[model samples]
Target: MTELGKRIVNILQKKSSWESDKERLLKEIQQMEDLDILQDVWTRYERVQKNPDISGTRNDPNSLLAYYLDITKEKPEEEFKNEKRRTYGRDGWPDIDMDFCDDRRHEIVNFLVGKYGRSRVASIGTVQTLKSKAELRRVIKALDPEKSINYTAKKPDQSGNFALQNEILGTLPKILKKRDGTLLKNLQEVYNEFNEFAAYMRKYPQVFETAKRMEGNISSSGIHPGGIILSPVDLSTLCPLHTTRGTNEDGQAGASKAMVTQFTMQDVESLGLIKIDVLGVSTLTTIDFATKLVKNNYGIDIDLSDLPLDDPLVLELYNSGKTDGIFQCEEAGMKQALQQIQINSFDDLMLAVAMYRPGPKDYIPQIAKRKQNPNLVQYAHPIVEKHTKSTYGIIVYQESAMHIFVELAGLTPTEGYTFIKGAAKKKPELFMSMKARFIKGASKISNKQVAESVWRQMEPFQGYAFCAGHSYAYAYLSWKTAYLKAHYPVEFICARLTEKSRRRKTDIVYKYEQDAIKNFGITIHPADLNRSKLTYIKIGEKDLLRPLLIKDVGDKAAEEIIRCQPFDPDDLLYSFGMKVGGAVNTKIVEVLASAKMFGNIPKPKVLSIFEAIKAGRQKSKGRQTGNLKKGIKGTVKRRKKTLDLDF
Candidate 1:
């Protein structure tokens, strides 16, 4: 065994609380070694271990060694009676996806570059190809830049060209979508299936034929968002390297100082390089911030990763359809599904995540009806019942299909995985051949009629089936967030506000601030000089001081105000002018006054004092400015009728 294999054995021997079967752990370690993935698993484990505070990492769900090593956080307990299923890449590379706080994900990436020499670590590149709609427009421009083609005229005339152009443009086919509303990448499939589109293409071969040739040509190259490749040798020696422009926070490409591979993710992986997906999930940041708030306000330290899966109040929040900040449960469709299904257990929540997708979506009503009345639940065969009993005897997961393929069809795990992938990729020949093999193999176990029936049950959902690993991981995060929101509403909202504020989404911040006030019943005080800091802070039992959300009042102004705490409303402008000049500008003061940061002092009076000071400065350009101070004092003293008007 290699050092990586020995380390895996050591971890399984010592850290086996999650999977305590010593013999089973050893077998899994040996299987990983035999599969030539042990070194890759160890490499990923080392990279992730450097960032101890990462949310979690998810490896191949079948890699029990990964779960034992804590590289994959979710346990692989059987959801239903389905046996375990493992899907490998064509080249047998294992996927190790790491999730981190969205705010701090750059730190880990930088650390990886430092550890592995900079030349060895680069972001995966992607080639942006022209799609059907873009190709149609491009072809139209290239053929007739000056005028449109007139199909109806004898001389190919230009008089009624615009109308004819509109007619031809209207025939451009809309992109095809999966049953789940996800846009499919294949325009050829769209052309083949839609009769009107195919007829129009044949009718207008000049434009359509040119478009077909130029449809998939590369337009631009850019870096992948999350995929980072770690090559053993210098990357430049193996493939070309390019410096890509940075993407802004708003997702626009701009000037950047980062290196990327010239090849795409598939090409890089094919070159025998390891790619680690360091996905930045903002919800993880939300959970982290909320937990820290809980610790600060209530002195209750929350270990979010170790949270119990079964919480009645969290489940009740999901049931109530008030999951505003909870992950995966906030969407209106998901909330409606929650209401209909009434998730009674963690298992149900996981199933809901899995089932609430495109192809499996059709089974939700059946599952709900079955859940409401258990007698309606029936399976085509015992194998089906055994695999799908947890999901109300319906195939709701891709793993369930794999179980049927292996157990019923008697295909090996590798063959079953290939069949599932073939179906997913829409490889008609591969899928049809596998389907034939499945029916033949299954007939020996059960009758031919029964085998076909069970296969039919699996066929419809195979393409759209959600991965159980993904559902479990997401459901775990969703429940953790729901638990925090149900118990600690103030902390969660404060965290959400701070995060949104950091992102410069003031509209969303204010929206959630109002939500916190109306729904959480928490009073949000406007940004105050005496109380407010850089972020939302819990002041009283039910009160939270809103951060400096006023426009033009940036970090410098907020920080200066914090430094000079407890400002008198009467002398705020004077104090800022004397102590924090330029930092607290006249516009910032005006906005603050408008935001009611000055307590009972009226907005007009504050602006007039600054106006009076400006007038006094003009009058005494070179002489004594003593009269300006007195004039500001006079303006500050006018606080009488402003109180009694009750405006």
Candidate 2:
């Protein structure tokens, strides 16, 4: 480890936490400068990366501030008297050849609106929403009354308008001038408004809970993931809240909430402030699927918490390729390999799980053959045996790489760990290139050919593979789930595949039929609205585990139906709030049908729901159109045509 890294570790050990954090991480070289080692490290790193720029130029104030200004800048020709670039200041400071007081005002207003609500947010922004000549006149008077309000210009009684445009663009009318400039104190106003809004929101527990539930779990809509809202007290106290003038750790440009709602999620984050980002994750969805099914099967009776850590059935399945229901072993190739080895223990299970992939699967058959006949299993060396005994002298996982690094390369725990994480998953070519360099840097290696051979062996385990610890943890979860599935087949499968929506409706159906119902000869009765449960269900006397597999029903619709009626399929549609005004849409019908709402309804009537859905949607569209027309007419009549002022 570098001296700085060691120092950081030492500091972390003492404090049991970080103080400066993002600042310290990005500007560690600043600390090193005190020791005179900064120049050497920075220079060397820059040379290695072949980067012309300094390592931390993002920390440069002038550069950071200039970047902020650039976001608000526009074409000079668009704003000025004409297109012109007048040079004035030296490298660090540049002069604005043209006044963008108009653009500045607009940006300020936008920022205010975002930080505060539209009603609360205010900056001397462009008076674009002026209601009348009086409102315009009031704004113009605020700027420079003498320069604006030309009562006797080309046309008489020019009450209010922009001053600059009045002389050049147009006559000043009763309105704020487009060139109305914003003062620095406007920023203070915006900041105050934003702070107030943050405080106001804090009063509402609902919003806070919503923000909390969504804290780390961002969805399709919300604030930016890494963006944080920093309050003054929080900023000065907890952390430095160091920023490049207007932004935070988040990818926020200088845009504020009022300025643009779009940037609530962008580059702005502080320590105590909230960070919300909506992310799409297949893993979360997958977990949702598993959880839903489990609920449906046992009427909330299944205990996922009761699953044991070391179930012999799961281990046996892992070894014997009977892992169809396990998370990792549902696939074809994995199943085939497992059946061959028929693993005998947890170590064997972990090995099977680890070696079941491409880079490792090739060695599986040989390993399996050897396990079946131990005489054929060759120990390449005592060192190799020491490293690979768990898997019979074969390197397969990220730990294998870490192991080689520790045993052969004499690297420290931290260094070995870093190499394992960084290089294990990398491609062979990358691993080879890095290994060559590492070997070349070694002084003990004399024969280049022998060194190259040793390096090649190191390449396989270096890229992005997991540390055995993580993989084993995952394997344990997998085994737990598999054990539940293997031993308590009906209860476990039902729990796993209960609500169609718990997992994908289709997937729940597939598992209920293919894996659970079929595997155990459990009956899958058609969904009957009168008797069907919204989740994976058990029917009277027969104890048949039926899935909500109604042809038209989706999981959500099914859940709603179940909630409204408690799985009584025999309930009348009208009784369940299916009003005559075409309330039967595709989603509603799908839910009802999936839950088997209609026991005797023919295909003819069932199909009619499609037309009903379309007709209902059309009626809704018509109402929307009429309302929109009314709004347009009302707005048009409200607008007075007596004034004409160029904005």
Candidate 3:
């Protein structure tokens, strides 16, 4: 054994109370050595087949090694072990999905690129395919070269008749999603099922033929939002590579600079490459900003990781349906679900997150009813009850489904995962094979009728069951945001507004402003020359001074305005014009003036001030200007007519 392996074994020996645990740790350590990870096991790892690798599958929340390695927050002995079994040395690599603060997620990506050479890591690519609607539109535009049919115009086409193209495109039926969560019923299915669509297709035979041929064709290629493939060797040897400004990890409307693989994520995985998702969650950024605001506003440094999961104030906020700034609970339906479930604890929050999806959503009221009266809860078998008791006898999570498969059907953890994946991905052959295995094994433990009964019970919602670990993470984030908003309302809302402002989502920022003033008794101050910073900053307990709220005033202009503070108190207007003249133009000054940034100066007056500044500077430089007052008035009048002062 390596020195590091021996040290880890020794540490486990001291902490483990049972000899069996010591034996298990020693075996795992040996496995790590065989996998060539003993020397450097601090990094998160998942062993691949006998091949040397360092990527891993879902972590066992109750595993001693997982906890000891600091890979998971839940302790080894935590009561809720909803995570699936960690299958080391599995046949294939499992993609690792991780979330980070959106504002700083690039730091992690950069770190990965540096640690692993840039040649070894690259973002995965995705082929943008044409859907049914897009295909129909493309076919319509191509067939109508003479412009007889207008697709976008509300009026008739050039022939002065109703546009048949609009009717044909509009007749395309919506996709019918199957129970397995796959869109099995797409364009072809629409034609088979809907007579109106079929008739339309039959009428336009050429268009239908072309649309069908073009459907699902590659329209373009783009980098995957968050999938990065890591290889032991240079990635170019395995697949094609290209440089791209990859899509943002935060799911926002932006991209980042990175090296991207020409192959898609699935294609890379099929080539035995490991893919990891490093998603940028904007909520994490909001939480970080809120915590810093708390430190600055209240002198209290909030350690978010160390927060108690069961804060009553947080629960009260959920129960009251006041989840305006809380993550994941902002949707109206989710707020109603919180009230219906009467979520009063952390576990309940997690359950709400898991059961809020489509397949399981129908059971929310039933789960709530069962929660009120535990006697009403019923299970298919003792095994099902054992795994699903926390969720009130409903298989609300994929982990619970896996647990049932392990105990009732005697399947290995890996086999159970495969079964769940087959069902979720709508692989009929794989799902049937696993179902047969499950029944054969379950029949040995129990009767055939009971085995079939259990399968029937799980079949309806098993495809939509969420990952327990994912739901828990989301619920924890929700709780943290709620806690901050509940205890530090002003700071949290200010942080939210600041983030929205940075994104240039002015409408949503104004909506939040109304919510704050109306609901939280907080006062929002407009951009003040003396009090405002580059972003929103808190004044007193209840007041928040906004950054520059003028249109066309971006970060650079705002920075210049903030830098030139106390703008010539003696000659305020002309001095203001002189200081911010270079960064902002006359239109920007008009907008800022209308926002009252320059105190009661109207937009026309602000324009006149800028004109005066220009004229005086020209005169001092020995430039003769005839009719200077007339020139300033004409400039101000013309600017006033064109100024967009609708902040």
lDDT for each candidate structure? 0.72, 0.43, 0.72
What residue pairs are clashing in model 3? Answer: 46-55, 46-56
C-alpha TM-scores of all predictions: 0.82, 0.46, 0.85
- In every candidate, how many clashes are there? 1, 58, 2
Q: What are the per-residue Cα lDDT tens digits for candidate 2 across 563-590? A: 5554323445423433223333555664
Better of 1 and 2 by lDDT: 1
Model 3 misses residue 1 by how many Å?
5.4
Q: After superposition, how far is residue 556 of candidate 3 from its true place, in Å?
A: 1.5
